[model samples]
Target: MKFILGLGKILTIAFWGVVLFNQLLPQPVPFNLLINAVGVTVLGLHILEVLFFNASLRGRSHRWFDRLQILLTGIFHVMSIPRQPQLPRNG
Candidate 1:
């Protein structure tokens, strides 16, 4: 599952890079609208993941960077982040 997620992140980043490059071209490409629409859809999905499934970043000091990682790398990055284990309190 982790491997699959990582692969997904890689593909997503590559796709966004292509879309951005296409947008920078002087003349609009034939598939510009389709690529941009897919890019927006992917961005929305990542934002939703950050909002709902972001347990790995709950108590971090540098949350902004973590969130950016989530945006760039998807849920695989979130899964790779190590959470501090909580110790039980002794009364």
Candidate 2:
């Protein structure tokens, strides 16, 4: 499970990295849509992992806040999808 948790963290970082990179670099609409889809799916899986696997949060104080923070971060990443067209290929 630790490996799974670690993978989740890495994926979480990657989702945000793509978002910021896309912000800095121009990308196409379809690419943006694909990013959004993959990011949202990762976010959902992370949330499920935290909610179902992290038993510490179930009966502890501030549990809601911790989960909320994760949820909010996921939402932010999901909403930050890029909107510009990608650079065209040149011959």
* Candidate 1 lDDT, 24-91, residue by residue in tens: 87236547877888778888988987887567677888888889878877777777777689889999
Number of the top-ranking candidate, with TM-score as the measure: 1
For residue 18, model 1's alpha carbon misses the true position, in angstroms, by 0.6
TM-score of each model, paired residue for residue:
0.69, 0.45
Model 2: pairs clashing at backbone N, Cα or C within 3 Å: 27-85, 27-86, 28-86
Residue 69 in model 2: shift from native, Å? 9.5
lDDT of 2 by residue, 1-91 (tens): 5555556656767767896677678479889778767767866876875666355445546766666656645433322322345589999
Among residues 3 or more apart in sequence or in different chains, the pairs in candidate 1 whose N, CA or C atoms overlap within 3 Å are: none
Question: Which 10 residues in a row give candidate 1 its minimum summed lDDT?
Answer: 25-34
Off by over 4 Å in 2: 1-12, 23-26, 57-91
